[model samples]
Target: MELTDTINQVVNLTKDEKLSIEKYFTVKTLPKGGLWIKEGQYCNHIAFIKKGICRIFYNDQDGNEISCFFMPENNFISSYTSFLTLTPTKENIEAVEDLEMLVINREDLEKLSKEVPKVQIWRRVIAENLFILLERRISMLQSKTAQERYENLIKENGDILLKVPLQYTASFLGVTPQHLSRLRKNSVK
Candidate 1:
């Protein structure tokens, strides 16, 4: 998947603007279980997944990992709070499977937006989508029962069974693994 193809999916850009934006992208591959960014390190680049899966997770005071979100093929991955504020990340981004991605440094992204106006539109669209997802996630946690959340997850991301481990899925849904197992079994019946 080319940079132009990904950008086009998110926002419309002129041919020239697309060409300039592409120049800033560097393609990289990560092995399964690779740690891309560790806690307390600044995330200097934003990654666009072309293949495989990655996840953003944080550790709780009890030293247990809490799964925040998963980034699958054709999705964008970043520690947004740290990236925007240029602060140390509180979360870790790890590759769940061998991954291919196109990355752009924060500085280069800023330069590209100034050089090519359309890139700004692309950035705004991406930010808006991120905000919407965050809002929906919060709502799901606050308003939905564990069973409802699990059902909604199955409805929205049916392929999750193929892509993610059950334990990780349980963590993402804010439930114990046994609870998720029961939910899954009940839903299947």
Candidate 2:
């Protein structure tokens, strides 16, 4: 379903509340390899994916891009800390394929949150959920082996292996591409 149709699952929006959404959101498209948000720039908006996938990543000291996560259809993507605080982002979010998004800027979001009570409650819910997800991700990375991480990723979203590039998936697992290849082979047997 399009984000517009499914938003109620995240936060129930009434007819009036849905109308206010139009005031805050704009539809944008990014081509493959295009950056929606770049490192060192202030993240102004949170985007809801209407189509395709985006990779969120950061560069390591060695200049290797480390994948943080992949946002696919119906998901939201943002450099959350930067978006919330209006600070420069240390991460980049780029399209893995041609992407369509419905985006809401921080200023408009804040205004809508103030004017629309449901939106304000939804924003708080989003924050709490994001925080929990972040904490879980950190804990998983710190405690799990590369193979374990790869298996967990498969458990969560098996299609990611077929849809996303192996290199990016490897980075997200904190393993080299070769290791991922070996893991895939082992998992098949």
Candidate 3:
């Protein structure tokens, strides 16, 4: 799908509003495993995935990489807290597959929001969606069992198995790889 179409699907923009958004977006590509943003660095841009998948992760206290989230095609990916606050990111973003992205810089987004009132509305919609997703994630982590979480993931994002590595998916689900394997085996039976 075209970038404009993707943006409109996310924000419900009018033709003129889409044209304005297009002015801020720049197309870019990254190879698999490429780091789009790193921990401790400022995130100056937000990426809208056009193709392929990206993972947001960070090194844990034990120096193990823990996957936080995945962004598939047509999804928005960013270190949102860092981007909003202009502070160092605690998360790292990397391409899981060769990726095509439409990126917009923070400065450009701010300028657009000021110039187009609709852009502010779009920003709020995006923020609200992110907030809801985060809340759901927190609840899942706090109350769901490993098997329940795995089942919920399969139900909500069946396509993720095809897009993300098993180990990464296990990490994102907050379980050991062995536990995930056992859970999957049990589900199949």
TM-score of 3: 0.94
Q: Model 1 over residues 61-134: C-alpha lDDT tens digits?
A: 99888998888888888888888899999999998899999999998988988998777878888889999999
**Regions of candidate 1 where Cα sits further than 4 Å from its true position:** none
TM-score of 1: 0.95
| Candidate 1, run of 10 with poorest lDDT | 1-10
- CA RMSD, predictions in order: 1.3, 1.3, 1.4
Better of 1 and 2 by lDDT: 1
**Cα TM-score of candidate 2:** 0.95
Kindly list the per-residue Cα lDDT of model 2 for residues 6-69, writing each as its tens digit. 6677777788888887668899999999999999999989888999999999999999999988
Whole-model lDDT, model 2: 0.87
lDDT of 3: 0.88
Among residues 3 or more apart in sequence or in different chains, the pairs in candidate 1 whose N, CA or C atoms overlap within 3 Å are: none
Instruction: Report, for every candidate in turn, its global Cα lDDT versus the true structure.
Output: 0.88, 0.87, 0.88
